[model samples]
Target: MKKIVLAIDSFKGSLTSQEAEQAAAEGILQVYPACEILQIPIADGGEGLLDTLLPYLQGHSISLYAHNPLMELIETCYGIASDGQTAIIEMATISGLPLIPPSKRNPFEATSFGTGELIKDALDKGCRNFIIGLGGSATNDAGLGMLQALGYRFFNKQGEELGLGGKIMKEVASIDTKSIHPALEEAFFTIVCDVINPFCGPKGAAYVYAPQKGADEAMVKELDAGMASLASVIRKTTDRDIAVCPGAGAAGGMAGAFLAFTNCLLKSGIHLVLEMLSFSRRIKNADLIITGEGRIDRQSAMGKVPYGVLTKAQEQDIPVIAIAGSIEEVNYLNQAGFQAVFSITPAPLSLQEAMEPIVARQNIRGLVSQICRVIEINPRVISSSPSHSKFSSFKKR
Candidate 1:
């Protein structure tokens, strides 16, 4: 039986990585039941990483009490690996865009403090190696609130402790590390981030990303000013100009805050996921590999999951096929080593309609079925076919 490795990202808002893999697996089985199938759910270190890592770590989910940007208590979830030696903290669970109400959306008011609380909880659970995701955040507070929760203290001019939130950062007069958790100093943190935006100014988190979180023109200006103020304080205290630091703008400047406050290392999220999944070792023996994301475009070639997977597959001289929600600038993926690319949508459907759980499953199943049919007729097409050569031939014709 031929060994096939099926790796795919969660179809955002449609299906989880496990469900997507099952749907594709069902399709492949229909065509070749005798073949061996392996499922590897993927994430680019953003929204779906928790699901992706759960299978590897033998982890389980737990609900924790957390405060939103407004300090309103809410129920949130994080994961602890089976070994109890690691933890997975998805920032979106505590400070995502969806948690805030539309009218109340305010980047300056949002805080990563709840995220800090989640981390503290994990640390208390005996988790010392942290894999923190740095995407889908709704704050620009520079992680001061998170630091505060970890025993660092943020104070105003009067030496009064500031409440947890971005708005409070503007009044900060000092930061005290004397109370920082002892466990934190011994811990190793890996921040999975693909963004490299600076902390302040036009290109910084607040100025560049506040509008998307419901900040208006005026709010953007105010948040930017607040971020600038926070940066000055950080520069004065840490002797590190975190405001100009690359990736400081990620997750609304949470990246900058984590770096300044902790001994965390920033890394390409997709690359880190690939390493944790051990995709390199698997690619060595696979006959053909498949990978995809919610969308495959020119950007997917730039260190995204599909690009990471395909790059490694290329090293093994294996071929790759991509299946995505929609195809945009698909020709771009060819250069990334994809032998073929397929879009999940069968007919014209609105984005919302396509995203319906059942509809997405059906679409992906059908797409995989179509691919299986072609593969049955010419299994070597993906295994040995010259992708760019075919394009060149077509151009010549």
Candidate 2:
């Protein structure tokens, strides 16, 4: 390998992208010490948004005192691009499922209020270009809780302010936006989203994701109804039916709420991240591209970072390989245009044992070394075939 690019996504719950890149680099260097290696830590927008963009945009992290899903105060941070006008906010930072302990998770009680607070803080910092990542939330409030934090009020028929959470959407008789933040009028928001479900339906936010946030059957139905009602009110306010919009179901319907309440656009999370970093240009001349996540499965083929990277490599006619913790259910990857996929778990270790960063790194290193050793032993192979014909040729016409 003359020039290899590492654009691996974070191995969630185990390795950061940077760490994975380093491990892969070590293994590659073990086999080809003179080869050039480039590391580009990446994310799919849900996780590692700030980490991935911090270097690309020359941004700085700004910490703020904020509230978590349950409304308790916590310290969180967002990113501001070097230009100082663009802010990157990951909704999971404040309203994420991981914020609350698994035992205390309650989608009905969780709120997106802190997400609004994070945006308001960025607005206060004079940021108007907002890239909001929408996923991993522990709320089903249709983002009304977030709106409340941004100074939009929700009043019941009796003029009483309703409590927080998806269940409380039942009492929302009307919305008051007169007190909304003025900055929102001028701000441009690009929501980083991946879900295609509408705001409310059988396949929507509540039914599809709420169970992971601790909701039961009844709560899902209630939250879905509430989301539908919220969408109706948003239509009245903005003349757009965001409830049925693609990705509106993401982040407890925050995608639709942002569109309805502010100047915002929706985009696929991985694509947006790639564009922001000008990944196409970077991958143009790469001899090889390495990328993967914690697992590679059917879902990985659907706009995940690995697939996103694969698309770019295929566009550039660069051979690509993936190093994943688990390679189950990814048999379609060869047809999807990947050269090869290797599991980081070297042996038949248990999930918990294999997922340890050290273990994963060792496995990744060993596998990469072995792959490189094979390449070194057969120089004619690279000249004749790419991944033994699994990948398209990178030869220039």
Candidate 3:
């Protein structure tokens, strides 16, 4: 092949997007040593988003001390670009579920204060444009803790300031935005959200996600009630109703808080990342495009990295192939536009063994190398055949 583009997502617990791309490149080079390969690490506004977008945005990391979900101090970092006018904050870096052990996971006591602290620092540094990724959060506070860190105050009926944690939402009877950060008025936020859960309700943040963050049936109901109460207070105070907004529940209603309190817009994670990266323009002349994530299932066709990359490649009639750690619904994925779908695993193995970084890298490299050999033997098999025909033949194997 003349030119190939590797636009792959992180393999979750194992390889990062860059590492996965590097492995794929190594495989391609084994067959075509002189081929031009372009690697673009990608994430759909989740854990690895900052690292994926920083270089393209001409940004640098800013490390600082921030509070974890349990209110403990932890060293964390965010990204700043365009001479500090723009900031990229991934919620997972600060208040993510992984930071808290399973034994310690408690949405009621967890807080998003650290995420707010990052934003506050960026604002102080003259950042008025914020790209915040709302994913993998450990709290269900409706962003009360975050707003507090940003200088907004919440008070109980006794006129007492409420402290941090999701439980505080139930006690919040009044909101005081008068002392909010002055720079907030000039700020614009772009929230990257993949889920469409509303701020409060049966399908909302607390009910659907709090359980995973250590809430039992009783705690879930309580957290949901608190979220509802906070939503009411937010509506009354800001004249903005975020209770039913799609994606408002993401990151434990953090998106709702930004909608209620700031000039912000919510966007689909993958689409926003693709647009920011100028994905279509970058792959305009690519002979082939390879994209994948940790797994490919029915959801993979729904705004995930591989689907997003496939759509962009389709616009230019470029054939796209996908390689994942595991795969399901192969027929559906083929219908979704991939010229071929492959699982990098060479043998039956347990999940833990499959996820080892070295093993994953080697498997991906070997898989891609074999794929390249097939292409080298008969270039027309991929370049000239219809997408469906190519996928159909591969499925038989």
Candidate 4:
């Protein structure tokens, strides 16, 4: 009716956050041509995080040649703020699983060396404030390869310097941080993560994620053992027991590596993104807030984008609506604080047909338009009560 805020996440394979918000805005405008709509692109610190935060941070993309998961050179890019003091790096762009073909997706052979190279470059460029998104990584080396690129060397019992890949983890008996980049002392890192798996155990990185990165059952066990070995060495080297920390296993134990060797803070992906976006202030006066992702289910109530948006809106007593391509546990979502949950698919269609960008945009727009029509017919439909003062004040305005 008045001011509406759109803070939606990417629809995975269908639409980006910006596209989804644009489609929703179109729908709202269809019913109320003069209504004010604010679009805020959002992500859960995964693939689209750099793009989502670039404009807001006044940053530009910087491209460079870096090693992929297989240690082959590839062109990748990260974001740097205009002031040159802050840099944003998404690990997925440099060493993600998607960069390697499924047949070649070997966690044992993969490396996060490229991610370290990006950080080293940023440090060289005079950046000391870093925001690193650790998601979709292809390696399970516990950040050994990344640390190697940053001048942290790993040596075996025979004083042999080990090379990259997860298989080398077990051979690492000693670490040398003396050659580390001089600029590291001034750097402060913020790691964006969502999972809470520990460094080494059944619920740890190797057991929980290595299989997805192309490790077999035997490889998983070996990788887990390697992580445990590395953790023991890290404890001796850094005097910090980072093995069982929550989220230590995220990005294949990359979070654990940072925790042990760097001045960094780990934050929930959605919460970090929302804080960076000033989400609470943005939605303070919104009459309605719309947020969703590709699917809404049990995970949606976890630290996902919709959950983050709902929390902020609820704090201000603003009504929130969520729309998804598909949804489950509708009753649970309603009980979780979403004023209403909607599925954008107007009719039954094949998954392939429904995922087409054009079709998704149309579905989103159509769904939002109808929702706006309902509100136009009866504003109280969205408001908590007919006598709600916010709606009363909005009508006077």
Encode model 2's per-residue lDDT on 223-299: one tens digit a residue.
88888877787788779888778888888788878778788889988998889888898776677788988889878
Write one digit per residue (lDDT tens) for candidate 1, span 164-217: 666776788888889888899778888998777888888888778888887888
**TM-score for model 3?**
0.93
User: Which one is best on lDDT?
Assistant: 4
lDDT of each: 0.81, 0.84, 0.90, 0.92
Q: Write the per-residue lDDT of candidate 4 for residues 190-257, one digit (tens) a residue.
A: 99988889999999999999999999999999999999999999999899897899999999999999
Supply candidate 2's per-residue lDDT for 139. Answer: 88
Model 1 quality (TM-score): 0.89
Name the 10 consecutive residues with the lowest summed lDDT in model 1.
Answer: 388-397
TM-score quality measure for candidate 2: 0.93
lDDT, candidate 3, at 114: 94
Task: List clashing residue pairs in candidate 1.
Answer: none
List TM-score per model, in order.
0.89, 0.93, 0.93, 0.93
Worst ten in a row by lDDT for model 3: 388-397
Off by over 4 Å in 3: 383-397
| Superposed model 4: Cα runs more than 4 Å off | 383-397
